[model samples]
Target: MSYQFEELFADIQKDNRKVLDDIEPFEHPLVVLLRKCLEEQEYMLDRLIEEFEEGKTELKDIKTNCSALFHANQKVNPYFAEWKRATGWIGYKDDTPSEELMKSLEERLDEMQDDLIEIAAKLDEEYGESTTKYFIPTFYLPEERVN
Candidate 1:
């Protein structure tokens, strides 16, 4: 695990460290759900790392996988920031991200086409075809993205 991961885990465990319980909620359910998903993912990571350290779970080829995961995580940060800015999720400051940022963001999204397609399919299945018109956006999340 990276030091950044460890630091995040430590903050969650430490009584004196900051907590996010007091943070105000966003107006939109989409933004709120996104934040919740990210938070849950972090918590899962913390648990996985803790289990690995406790000898309760085994890591598969840690040197290779963790390094790859770390590199992927690093690349994800800037793309996520750009996506949030473009979507106006972060704040009122970024009404529009730059053209370069949009291209970079789109490239990252393109990399996840298979996953996006699967998710879209599942969403369509669960919510019905008509529900997708409101929930599954194809303009930003292209239908051509399907693998």
Candidate 2:
């Protein structure tokens, strides 16, 4: 069953000083519980990472598909064509993507990328620039108990 992690953690943090001050150095129940909760959180965090990876893959596929479609329709509307990387040339005489549609798609893609960056920032403030995971926890942690 699911646990009220926030409440449990908060309550322990509030009583952290007392627990450490009064209890023996041996394994305390609160410490044990908090450790278990953190382990469970690790699993949840792993899932979040997996989902982010999936989203990034999906975004790449969408960008590739858009480029292919634009290239395919370039035969009818050269003005709406994009630069071709392979041939070092601009669009062909394409008609599939009208100027308006291309503009809209570009705008939508930009928005989608922006959204992805925002989510990445939440998972990692530097967005993979730093070595650490940089995940901000949802719950406060109890301080270490010393002998």
Candidate 3:
């Protein structure tokens, strides 16, 4: 979310051309863009995971009945549904959060999904379905890309 498409792409083009070009010689720019976006999401999720592990937030009280978790989960559910439709990716057990803090993190991830889905749509439109078949790691592709 902190990164912008044009700026990030330009940074990649300016800095990592050799590395990217070497690995994905014929890769479309959109594919490179999507990869970076997913990487950003990965970093965000890693932070959340670290926090959860460190007990930085009190997330164990599930029976307290907070609507925040429900609303956040609701917001994130549809994003995963769309992601499954778009990529045939399923990440249920690995991605679901255990408590309230996770639910909020899921909402944040849902917001980040917009950039990813937009780039994917553009990739599909410009280069066809073949180019849309890029890999999204399980970490970032939580049960719903944030569960």
Candidate 4:
């Protein structure tokens, strides 16, 4: 069965909740800042959904934008791996994304990552807590090679 974008989004949210629960207490300012960043991501996803349903944007367009966002995340800094993981939920049953769509998605993701990095850096500077270290790397090599 093919999952709709909304369904995929729901899954991402569920995973995000799990991550939040695992973190708990959120004593660190960096953790608080990361939560805020997640909130912004939720807002952006909601906007994408609204735009798609309203016909302001097509599904392909949305997919393209999402792909760009992921690509950008990889390029700017690998620290925001969780964000990249969230985007992976956006996939189709066919398991094949158009090149054009992929390019657009990469671009959008890159831009979003920049915004997130800036937020993280500013939060660290202002709040005096560096939480960037907590971000788990989203990409991994084969177990045989690393371990």
Among the numbered candidates, top lDDT falls to: 4
Model 1: residue 96 alpha-carbon error in angstroms: 15
lDDT of 4 by residue, 50-134 (tens): 6545644443445444443333334433323433343346542243333454355445445444444443343234333433223
Between candidates 1 and 2, the one scoring higher on lDDT is: 1
Worst 10 residues of 2 by lDDT: 138-147
Q: List ranges where model 2 is wrong by over 4 Å.
A: 1-94, 126-147
Candidate 1 vs. true structure, TM-score? 0.31
Alpha-carbon RMSD of each model: 13.8, 25.8, 20.2, 17.9
lDDT of 2 at 16: 31
Would you list the rank order by lDDT, best first?
Answer: 4, 1, 3, 2
**Residue-by-residue lDDT tens digits, candidate 1, 20-119:** 2311233344334434543543454456456445643333323233333233333444545544664555444434444564455445434433333443
Q: Estimated TM-score per prediction?
A: 0.31, 0.27, 0.26, 0.36
Residue 43, candidate 1: C-alpha displacement in angstroms: 2.7
* Top-TM-score candidate index: 4
* Shift in Å, residue 61, candidate 3: 45
> lDDT of each prediction vs. the true structure?
0.40, 0.31, 0.35, 0.42
Off by over 4 Å in 1: 1-23, 60-147
Among residues 3 or more apart in sequence or in different chains, the pairs in candidate 3 whose N, CA or C atoms overlap within 3 Å are: none
What local lDDT score does residue 87 receive in model 2, on the 0 to 100 scale?
16
Clashing pairs in 2: 73-94, 74-93, 74-94, 75-93, 75-94, 76-93, 76-94, 76-95, 77-94, 77-95
Answer with 1 or 4, whichever has the higher TM-score: 4
Model 2 whole-model lDDT (C-alpha atoms): 0.31
Q: Given candidate 3, what's the lDDT at residue 23?
A: 24
Tell me the lDDT of model 4 at 51: 51
